[model samples]
Target: MEMPSLYGRVLPSPPAVDFNSAEGKRLFSEALQGGTMEGFFSLISYFQTQSEPAFCGLASLSVVLNALAIDPGSRWKGPWRWFDESMLDCCEPLDKVKAQGITFGKVACLAHCSGANVQSFRANRATIHDFRRHLIRCASSQDCHLIASYHREPFKQTGTGHFSPIGGYHAGQDMALILDVARFKYPPHWVPLSLLWEAMNTTDESTGLHRGFMLISRHTAAPSLLYTVSCGNESWKSIAKYCVEDLPNLLKAESPDDVPTLLSHLIESLPANAGALIKWVVEVRRKEEGRPTLSKEEKERLFLKENVLQQVRDTKLFYEVHGQQYAKSCCSCSSSSEEDSLTRIAAAVCCQGVAMLSGNLASRDGLCCRETCIRCIQANGDGLKTVISGTVVSEGNEQAVDMLLPISSPYTSSCNSTVSDEIVNYPSNTDVLTVLLLSLHPNTWLGIKDEKLKAEFQALVSTDNLPDVLKQEIVHLRRQLVYLCKAEEAGSHVPPSH
Candidate 1:
């Protein structure tokens, strides 16, 4: 059987290259001498396709040779079996070589270049590492470029022999660049491109995943970008893309201005009706500023003013209802004496006699005698004195007069005797005198004269006389005694009848 000449149609030759550059010649010589025949062909093939190859020629050579070494019996195996049988063909391409190359290019660009024998390349660690490093360099040089690796096998059943490859690379130095190249659209197991880049740049392993899978990027220098993908329960696909770009921005914004702008952007990105919640929050904050704020002294002043105003209004209303006439009279009286006007006003309003004295009264405004009106006029001090005198006089009977004065005459001739009698008898009828005597105690009678004392004793006895019935009994007994004395005198010689 003769195979068709698929050389130009399937696997075309590489474009012409200037072997002028020392680096280029050195690479070419190394590939030929190292028994890496596929690597040399890959270099030539890369130049033939496009002016600037999308993938590194060296990386492509390493990938293909490594894949072939894993599966030696494959038809696509190259001439690299001379160095080590361990490096013989292992990766068997499912389609033709040209188709495989096209697939590999697309997969690499999408960051999914692990479809065929990627796991088998583990035996060739040097080749795999070199390939990964070359991809990183290529992607790093171009801001738009990204690369990724993946495991092509379906999810393994429990206890099955299937496994994942390219899981060791973190965000910063290795697999992170692939994530960055793919723009973080690779497998869910890969860390975010931004985080992988950050991790690579920062060299921070702690920033990325410990197990499962991770992505990293070099977006910032301070804190490395890092994100994890877990296959345990939840899917990482939904949040993976967002986390790469949004998380870094969220963590970096520190000022109020930045926060509001960020928050607005976040709100806008949410589903409809979510913006209403944020609007409500902002309104509440604005309302808080309008409520009254009070100071200690100002509050106290307001309270005092209210009390004074209430008092003044009450006083005015009272005067308007009861003291209108007196108020008019007070004007005339005030000219003669302000005390007199206040006294008249108090008496008119309270219906009591009042006196105003200089020592006992003063005005609220320091103009008129307000205290005199309150004490003397409203209290009727003069009328109280008169009532007291009248009470004493009305209580005076014949026995009362005798008890009060102890004078030989029926009537007390001296007014001094009346006063003395009143002073002495005061305690027997009044609580005030009793309290006064208690207060004076042993010195109570010190200033009292003998005549005054006699009058006081008489008054006390008179005030505390026996009842009329007892007095009548005494009178009858005295009469009976008189009759007996007369009968005894008349019957001096005769024995009194038994």
Candidate 2:
């Protein structure tokens, strides 16, 4: 039986030469002969078709990461640690990437976050000579791969921007093999190196930066064992403002007697919405405290595994004890009246103060009735119960939470006024304090006079536990935080325009 030819899918010339074409075949052969097909041979086995229309960048990255044998350090599925499009979401949220394709800088950022040594070059920053030199080197090395972020319109492809790995280089013909991740639209092809460079030389209107390329290879050092920052520069700036600006003001205005209130205020003031809050909290494993089944040694081992800031653990432990005392003192109150019960529960310190900050004291101006407000309280309480009871698991990944909190008003029972469970379990003091410590050095809080508060906030700032690359990134963010805070202090601050 003869197979049907799918040559019609091959894009016409002036754009790219399809790999099955005679010219492309000859280019591949020559590339192999010239020993420049090392990357092609290494990457071919791991090449993937993008799962989403806007996932070209992630697909390209997964190919390169797997080719270099870089472990993702987390399970991609049951018992498998591998690179996938879903795991490449350390820089931008996957939903955002799904709506609008990733940018060149973000691609490099994701690569760096995923344990790769990444060197990114914007079209404006590097000469064509430099690109060609890097391209040739990448093509010749099995360990290194180059991903081009370019405008597809220049190649006559039906898209604005696209990302694909450069598999091989035909030095004689000056053509490069593009292992296009969008296999549904196009096949692997060869394009003139200069034409590819021209495509990359265009501007990405979204970033106001020229599109370019990234050289990615495996990092030789051990990856970060515990913490990694995931949010963008803008969010980091917001954290810095809250830490260095809003926090100091709050501290100065309040007394040590108002510590619980102060902690609640800090949690409520955080810039991260529900989704971001979830991401931050899940990084730290939840400790199963007061489990009689586990011995003290077992409990200590479990605490060590909850690889979060030591101060955060201590603060949580303190809150647990504090909350228990508050609950016991109020145990004698009557629960006959529903309204009184709701009010009493609302006022109680719950979810390590996250429930109080997010549900009870959280603004409810838009809510339609008392039931909706009560539901919010209940959902938050339930979510916290789920978190502390160690029942929060999605599929096999304990860190994931794909559930949404149903928040329908009574008047419109079918309305889609739902919130992510992430938001329901929003930033507690532990989470906000972590951000504060990350944004401003702990020494900045030395002005506090409360012995207990001082002990909680006095945890030494140490970057030694972080990977060198991530430490460098944190240092950069700290510097940016300082500059932003200084600009605001000078009264010359201008809000950024979206």
Candidate 3:
């Protein structure tokens, strides 16, 4: 007669078959030594559905066989158990199974580990503590960073020691720890896992240094979301692939021994846009509720539209050129042509200075020569002939000219010529002269004692040829000089001259 098979077909009993006795060694041998893949899968499937006692018994047997399969001194032994634990837990162990029976329970939790959940992680204190310890041990063996969970009260204040435990640790290093703390009771499932991976893989560009893993409740989220691991700036693509792709694969893997391999893949895949990726992930977590889910195309479009990369690129250009002062003066004489304020002021001052110097030189040349003496005297009635001719004669005659003629006469004639010149050049060089004269004190020229000078200045005041600007300045200066002279006369011993 044919022997019964564990699954499907039947075969003759092997020499080791002992159906009456339930032996751990025999069962493992049957599972592993089974020739076909069908037998192996059937055995595992049957083991998963068994009661706690039966499955635990089988688990113990599997453990022994696993140990014997590897050399005592090999590094593979510990890792093998870790792997078995993940697989057994995921597939439903044939051994003892805890029956807290939370909604979606272990199945959902395992699915979450594989990046299947949209809600945030919110485990009880006991669960969080247990998960943290396991993660720490596993990460340590693989030379990965360990992170811890931080918990605090909701809102009520008890005593100083009062605190409520929150979410558990995801990943991080010694210096900085990443906490997978929940903001709301129902966070989008991918948030916790994404945050965890970001904490683990972020690297700093400056020192190529990595930071400790960190996570805080939404209520307590840090101002900055980016975390760095190694010094170089990793790209967003690398970050997304490692955190979403590699880390999820790590959790679903059958052997704990594969942890190092998973970690190696993650570290090697660090992205160039790691910082930006972290920012995007955190932003998603925060705004996940009200915002519409972004499609891949929409995300790419928005990212490019915002032009963050372009802004970064343009920073230097903006500071170097566009930031400079481009202000221009809008004064009347600055040629209606737009120019900087400083440039306009400088040009005006320069033009005024040149005109004043030229006028002074012309007056001096005309007054000193006998040929031009009459014309200079008529133009600037300073008695230039008397002043200059006296010098050519004896010194004795020069004193008579100085004493007889009033000092005001020559200055008055110069003032008259300035007034007349303004009429000829109004709105041009006249405007320049008017501005200059307006800036001078009238008393300096008007106070001269020379009779001819006084007469000439009086005549200039009477000249109808003066431009409006020159006329206004002369009137203003005359009033000011009159007030000053009156004040001086009042204070002096000399009686006022009518």
Candidate 4:
């Protein structure tokens, strides 16, 4: 096996360290608090790790990714996960390269293509002082990370271009807090800004571009629908083959024991907002009647659409790269009766995370993800009403007469002749659900916090003419509301007088 050599010289050292020392422990504690770089030097939640021999660039990006809270798991308390080298290596664009290591340009390209917000700077045109001043300002908060790229050889390092997050900068001492991702080899320490700048000017053998810096900023965009919700997309087969077909290995569901762990990890990785949104969607979806079943022709056409296939590919790659889990071992699966069942379950759980994070964390019907759709409608002296465009009228779904009302099962078998007709003719269940959700909070879908409003909504659940599916959903929702109400009462909320 040919070993990695820089300038044809040998440097014997482990590629990374575990950071198990007392100082290492303290740093880890500080980082979890979301480290800072204020008048003093610190970076809370500046997640770090060891790098694979030739995966320094991938590893360094991972640190920046977490520090900027790019992944949903950044807010997690227990041991959190970040994108690993396996995921970065899985990139088809980067894989086509003939070079031994990733290039600076390629890393930036990959990050941007993956929906990561990034801004790069080259040392060739700028002075060290100019860069240092910027670093001091940007590093003042945990929302940005300065990924310094310089030649390691100048600093007596083995590699040509090395990358790590400059977590903190002390202007007084002209020192930079290097949160070295190559921890297996060395722990993080402060370095002279001038010396590090000299290293940045070194040339990279792969791209031939001078090594520089990139600040991975907070990813403000929501994950998109195309990136999640396979929802019987025909192109899913090819997408599975190309991108996440290796999910079994990526998620490491090698044994049955792994499934529960993977499940727990996936749930933990969900942001609090995403969880609330999911609950709202599932509840609202339960109220609707008849999902739009795909016809043979429409299903066949969608299965083969090039655009759909590409979407599946993007969604698959997105999860592998940004998924916050310890083991990338869940997705690898082969075609068999038993394994197929597990694969479907795992895929659904993982992909849902993508959907939840995206602006799509919405109604179960996959509608009303935007702020514009949320409108507040108050109740009258008689009862509640849905006011659309300033007019009061019976919505198609809620237009059912008392005779047509019958609580149905959640399963499809519950759809009877009367219900099926209503589903086809009055497909306004989602609109009604949308109004209900809007009533809670138009600005945020976190949850229904209004105890009095929730109490009033409970009356609607008891209507004799309500849909069975919707009623069952209300039952579940009431449980959540009960919990929320109790929590508020027990905590600090004061009840308002009528």
Candidate 5:
């Protein structure tokens, strides 16, 4: 059968010079002579086509991320750890991204979430001269990359908005090399810097936000071992409102004894977009209320989604319980100043340079990563054991064993070794949450009186008969927990605060 066209070609009418054309090669040679093609080799090494029509941003990000040797901290397909469009779901859901594409801010948010240093400039917020300077800096440096979100119409291209990494610059021609992710439609091309800025200056109709450019670089510290919660979604405001305004009011109006019932009501009354916070609660409730037996096929179908929910719940519980432990533990070093204390913690945990701190060492007021280095430590008797189980591969009988692993076995551990690690050093917040959950004691979940929450806790901590990858993740977390114990033991002279 004859195949239909996938996308239209980039018309020669566009002002941009195709990178493979004679004129393009001439300009690129000139760019190299002017020392503006320093970053070109790095990007070209990992250049990839966007897998989906609307996944240009993801593709560009993946290229830059890999070029910079940034670890995605998660497997891409099987055993290899790398960045892929599918792994970039922290800022926006993949389904939403596939349908609506992504915005400049969201792209920057994803870069930041992936443990890269991001500096974003919307067209309205920055002048043309500023963009030119950034372009030169990015093109002249292999350490950084520039991604532009611009309107295709300005370049007379076939699409609306687009994202592509700026691979090189030509000072003499005043041109920028766009390593367009949508290679099917447009090849790598050199467009006049002024013209590219004009494209980026246009407005995106959906977000009512200006198109822009961003500079992404690797973070100075090592990637974080644990995941943290992010408040970047549309439901963040409602979640915050519920936590700050609604929760306080609910507590004050109800008696202490009635609070539990009120909370249960609150769970039921929560808005549908309570987002990631409530799905696990609802799942847990359904599991307990129904306790329905399922066929092997059903369990296999639900495994991926359920595992994600469990990981999220685990991270939330960890931050709630031990977010402040690192600060407290560092203070135990008896350093004379906050800087000195941070220095000690860095030496102990990072083992390289200073471990990056989130805020003032005295307070846990912000969302810094307080749980790092737990993986390097060995799991003492108190921490969860590293249990290697069945492979995550989907088949007949093994799927049943992986699904039936006991989730809520009772666990007891001494609180003596429960010291916290570094803050906010992780790449994706999801990873942060996953690692944090691993460090948790079974008793932490068992202490909660709410049956739904308890069920959610069980899901988070359960390691029995899981897929190999997930079990490996648990082992990593347990390793981190072991470090916590070691840190606590070193400072055992100062008793841990309850």
Candidate 6:
């Protein structure tokens, strides 16, 4: 059946050509028979109609994605097809595409996330020769396919701009086949080499970037992970595939619980990005332990100002993740009871201090949370009980109740602690509070061999307001017990979880 189009209805014109067919080639041969076709490849993909006529770019991308054998929530093997509606719903919503068409970055990112090898290049006046060469090279490879973006005016076509695939090239005719994605709007046809080149050189209005071609190949090695996820479970492999793509961004999530992780992958990914995390962590410790200096006023001003913005960022994330419901805003915090404040603070330490620091924290980054996330672990102590079943700790010397030290720096410590005795569970009389504090906030309890890591970590742990129970434990252990600086610094983000 014939399709309706505005171009034919509004003006006198011949039917648009579909070069992939025999009749169209006969027409091309009769009209512009300059040379025999050197290379030919074609994948007939349908055009889109739902969003706006302007969605030609998306339609073209959908075509490329399907041809590359990458799953976009569906079957990979195809005589190839791109359902624009499904693509929009899964990744770019329709309204978003309508407002400001997609970018090559977004398209490439989608392809990359789908496990395709994507190579893109923008065309310039001098680069056309190289582009032609690359096109021929790609045409020879079965796994390779191309998406081309060019303005329509140069071709004297109906639309202003469009995206389509260059299915075949004729060194003989010096004409390239444009497998137009808007085949419903304009039939697939051949445009002269010079005209197609001119069209690609046109600047796109949306991104202010010149139009170009992106080559996608499905056959490639596995994407490199900074570190391997240790799980042999297939379900976990799926989640890890989805999670690692955004792990760095997840690290900056507003709250520890905002992007919870499974205790499993957390044990894996933490080591890979620990350095990036500590970069911010050291700053947090510094701000919380800020002190008046005996140095000149100039030095002090710079020191305080350096961390001002970082402090705001850290606190913003903390409060945003645990807003009024759990940790109230500064204005309303004044009315909360002291007990509430202590409990909330303790929860924060348990979460951000250990879980987040060790990547034991999580959010729905696709790793199925086993209710061991920071929010769960910090919920009424029951969640934590499952993990810290080894032993209990006891309160000790009552004299150290208020031993708040004026910690000067994150790396330097005047005090020291070694095991006061053998590694044994806390005594039967050990306070429940002490056991909870020790087990939950063990980042400060594990030891470190790296002197520099130990110092920076020691300073942060020392800065924490030791609850009376912790103070009693510290005094009882004669301060011999060490916390988790080395455990985390062991060059892996995964700490030893009980």
Candidate 1 per-residue C-alpha lDDT over 1-498 given as tens digits, one digit per residue, 9 for 90 to 100: 997552221111111112334533453454334433222232222222111122222233233333223221112223222112112111222132223222222222111111111111111122334445543433333211222222221211111111111212232312221111111122213333333322222211221211112111221111100101111111222232233344334434422233234223332333222111110000000112232232343333333333322222233222222222221111112223212332343222221111011111222123321222121010122111101111011112110000010111111122333343221111011111111111111222232234454244233322124333222222222222222222112211111111
State the displacement of the C-alpha of residue 109, model 5, in Å, after optimal TM-score superposition: 1.7
Candidates' TM-scores? 0.15, 0.54, 0.13, 0.40, 0.54, 0.42
User: What lDDT would each prediction earn against the true structure?
Assistant: 0.22, 0.57, 0.25, 0.39, 0.56, 0.39
Error of 1 at 30 (Å): 10
Candidate 5, residue 159: Cα displacement in angstroms equals 1.5
Q: Which candidate number maximizes lDDT?
A: 2
TM-score-wise, the better of 3 and 5 is 5
Q: After superposition, how far is residue 366 of candidate 2 from its true place, in Å?
A: 24
* Model 6 worst lDDT run, 10 consecutive residues: 397-406
Q: Evaluate model 4: give its lDDT.
A: 0.39
As a whole number from 0 to 100, the lDDT of residue 203 in candidate 4 is: 72
**Candidate 2 deviant stretches above 4 angstroms:** 1-8, 232-237, 240-498
Model 5: per-residue lDDT, tens digit, 309-342? 3544445434443332222111112333222332
Q: What's the ranking of the predictions by TM-score, best on top?
A: 2, 5, 6, 4, 1, 3
Candidate no. 2 TM-score: 0.54
Q: How are the candidates ranked when ordered by lDDT, highest leading?
A: 2, 5, 4, 6, 3, 1
Question: Model 4, range 1-498, lDDT digits (tens) per residue?
Answer: 997754423222222212355643454445435433641232335455644555667777765665555553211222344454444432322334324666666566445434355556667766787777678666676556677877776556555666777766655546566676766655666566787888887777655567777766654433321121121222323422322233223333322233234334433332222212212121011112342233343333322332322322233222332333332222222223212232232233222322332221222233211111111121223111111111111221111100011111221212334333221111111222222222221112112234443343333222233433333333333322222222112211112111
**TM-score pick, better of 4 and 5:** 5
Estimate candidate 6's alpha-carbon lDDT, on a 0 to 1 scale. Answer: 0.39
How well does model 1 score by local distance difference test? 0.22
